[model samples]
Target: FIMENCDELMPDYLNFIKGVVDSEDLPLNISRETLQQSKILKVIRKNLIKKCMELFSEIAEDKDNFKKFYEQFGKNIKLGIHEDSTNRKKLAEFLRYHTSTSGDETSSLSGLRLPHEGEPDRPFYYITGESREAVANSAFVERVKKRGFEVVYMVDPIDEYCVQQLKEFDGKKLVSVTREGLELPESEEEKKKFEEDKVKFEKLCKVMKDILDKKVQKVSVSNRLVSSPCCIVTSEYGWSANMERIMKAQAFRDSSTMGYMASKKNLEINPDHSIMKALRERVENDQDDKTARDLVVLLFETALLTSGFSLEEPGSHANRIYRMIKLGLDIDEADAVEESTSEPVAVPKVEGAEEDASRMEEVD
Candidate 1:
């Protein structure tokens, strides 16, 4: 029937689609042409999808078989999360990844057994990076893990994008705990301090924001960062680092609409970080100093690179490093680098080696 109704049927999409088409109006399906327009075809397609999803869900419920299914069809599940809004919640339930709580191994959704009452069930949070090791050891996840939060190590390129589309799962919000807009509960004292700091650094923050206007949507002091001086975070609605990486790796680099949808990121500096503390002191004491200005630029550029964004001016960072080194060494910034010259040097050459002798003579 499919072969005969090739003109009406979508053949490329029919492969592996196994189902029966029953039409009440057809005389047991009279002819291929007659069956092509049968209203039963629509019902079959819907039923087939429902059956497939049910089968998938059943398989997903089986821990042993779901592992095998995930190994083979995980990408399809991730793609569904990206493309199918209506079914994203269902697809997310099937997705799995390694988490700190999983204890040095990977686990599935069915296996995410939370701790009992009186024990904190810090739902597994995660950040995406190029490697699991990197994500696991990142500064962003360090504090989260310290607080006993189980962070899923999402190294896969699609993991971040897929999770973003799925905002919640099993009554828990899928959160990028590294995002600047994160609202971790803070004490009244900490909140008051944060407000005071914001007021104190208002001018410097404005200046930093102005300088980074093109690359960052905004600049603000963050409570998320602990050890790291600064980090960058995307807007709640923007593409994440992993999404940007996946989009940029596509075959047709500039073709995808996702490339255009990617927006500028926000730079979040830790006010308590030593680097920022020093910067704040310097800005308050001598805001117009060239050295302080250079440090600000360096900090912003470093934040960009650390946050998975490319440096706009690599040379500027290098020069800033040189200047900082000059300051550290108490050397004149103008004379930081010694000029290269072909000046003669006193050196002895081996006898009976005329070419070596000439080379030594040139240096002398």
Candidate 2:
């Protein structure tokens, strides 16, 4: 009976419990209440969890079968990581994920390869997104990949929460690619170039910070962006854009608290981009250029949207876009008439509709 109802006997995190246990030693008078409160039952449950871990370990030894098992019940294991504090490390061993090294294949966290180098091993990198393609093509992953690091693609929504619970696995800290503190190994020449760009773009960065003061924590050149013009990153201890989206979508969550928690983000511009170079020149040459400042604000807001952060002033963004559209089409804003706010005239009642209504009322 316990085997058949193992889900009931086990905790919610262990709901995937299967198989049978036949023991003549259990008391025949073991009522449901007794099973609930008995020390013997506690021993049985502890033994059962141990056996389950052993069985999973055996299954994981065979890649094909483990893949099947993970596909069928991986989310439950992630839930166990979040709920089972006693076996969190063991649960992490069973966690399988899509990693960059595996191509299309998935590998367990323990089985994945650590970076081989003369230097110390870097933190385990991972990216969370709505889809595998979304994470794969992300600007955040570019620098990590360029540095020959493996990044786990976290497609499932539960994956983020799972990593949060299982913070560090096997002495390696898990770091999100979208968050701050990711330092790539740079050559001396590259370092010199970065320093030059920082000094050269210092005023431009300050101008950007001023323009986007309320929306972003700061504006600076990014080490992560290789191809993309700009991207947004969160503070080391703050919630990520993905996390912010998840929290904001919670129906019962307090908006005011979410606002406070999700407010600040950093705008990271690719200083190598041509537009960035031109903007730097423009800012240096004419710091008071309204057009250049508007462009900076527009780029910042666009990056905010692309980086999965919500826009606080979408209407302002739209107006800027409209202005750009006019500029592109060679339409002068000076020639455009302002939209009228005069009260619209109500159409005169159709000639005999009132009389017809009166005749109908008289007939009734």
**lDDT (CA) for every model shown?**
0.70, 0.82
Per-model TM-score versus the true fold? 0.75, 0.86
In candidate 2, position 5 carries an lDDT of 69
Candidate that would win on TM-score: 2
Displacement of the residue 8 alpha carbon in candidate 1, Å: 11
lDDT of 1 at 39: 58
Model 2, range 34-65, lDDT digits (tens) per residue? 33445767777788888889999999889899
Q: Residue by residue across 1-364, what tens digits does model 1's lDDT show?
A: 3233322322222233454444445422444444545556555555655667789878866778888877877877787788767667766777788987776557765466553345443454668878877676666775676665667777777676677677767776667865666765567998999898788778778777776567677888777777888887887777776677777788886766765667467787787888888888877787777777777778878876676666767988898888788778899855766777868787996677998878999999
